[model samples]
Target: MHRKTIVDVGTDHGLLAIGLALTGKFQKVIGVDVSQQALENGALSLLSQIESRRKGIDPQKAALDVPVEFRHGDGLKALEEGEADIVCMAGMGVSTLLQILEQDHDALTSDLNRRQYTDLILQPTNSKPRNLMFLYKSLQDSGWELRNERIVKLSSRWYVTSHFTRPQSNIPVTALIEDGAMKIPGSTLDCTLSDSDPMRQDLEEYCRHHSQWIRKDSEYGRMDLLEEVWLERFGNDR
Candidate 1:
């Protein structure tokens, strides 16, 4: 796989950065944290490991360089525009994450156009399904599309990671559906869909059948209320 520039926002310990660097998955890796102590500790921990690795190499041998750096800052403020090809914001609350995006919207927009950022990885701290819906709509309005999503079930919570990209002229219809909606081709309700994988056809059929009950009792007034709430919260900026 081709190496890409990667930035991890709210990186508490910098383990992700270290792992990516050591694995050579990223040409450059940056770990950003708001806490100075956390940045220092993470940097020290990574440096110690690098030093340990160097000891095993011959004095005359050139060591494999580690491609990572640690920085202390609020969100992407410390990063230069167009610096990273993949931006990751993990282990943060939905509102906090939204605030970060709102604060750096202009910079991010410029970078997205200039560098053509291929991926945005978001891992929310809590299972806020409504927040996720809000985020999805926000991204869509901002000219971005959800590329992929995964819900990892842990002992206590589900870690939801969503990957997004700038929207293109023609997106596959299968990718336009939201979760828990009808998946039928001619259905009124949209289900979580994707065109990249053909094997998901059965899943689409299942969603179509499952959403029949919801469509029967669904209230248009309730949906309007939800839309109003989202608008009040997110505003026209999204």
Candidate 2:
């Protein structure tokens, strides 16, 4: 795996940061948290782990390693400009993630090369499906384009990772948006297939799921728009 600079936000115990550093996945890891005591305790724990590892290896065989830093501050507040390439915000809620984005939006937009910041890996707790949509939309509006997504099943809940990049103007139109969403003007569709065919099966499947969710009065109103799009695309097919 390629080495990358990693910043893990809300790093409580610093295990992930230490693990990444030990595995050589990252040259350096900065664990950021708002609580001073948490940072102090986490740093102590991380240092102990690093020392334990060093004791097992002969000095001649040991590789020089970068020390992990623990910073006490709000999300990205203590981080210097262009300090890291990957930002991992885990063990936080969607609302907290949005708040972080709002607070750091200007700094992130101005200092970082949006194209080079390869990923925003969020593992949000207490997130509704629509909150995910809202997050996706907000990133799009901020000039970041999602590149990949994955849903991992954890012991109790699902964790999602969304990797993004700054959109290139020359990329195909449909590649810029979500599967069931609309594209912005001047975006070119990447597919050679007819437009009608792209959403034919999607509409049918969405309707089936929407009807089920609607019957239960789920709080996700975006499903209504999905159902509407499905109906508009395949009215008589049902």
Give me the candidate number with maximum lDDT.
1
Write one digit per residue (lDDT tens) for candidate 2, span 115-147. Answer: 256667766774334455556655665556666
lDDT of 2 at 140: 62
Name model 2 segments beyond 4 Å from true: 1-3, 60-67, 105-118, 167-215, 218-238
Give candidate 1 misplaced runs (Cα > 4 Å).
57-64, 105-116, 169-238
TM-score of each: 0.66, 0.67
Name the TM-score of candidate 1: 0.66
- The residue pairs that clash in candidate 2, if any, are 173-188
Model 2 whole-model lDDT (C-alpha atoms): 0.59
Evaluated against the true structure, the overall lDDT of model 1 is 0.61
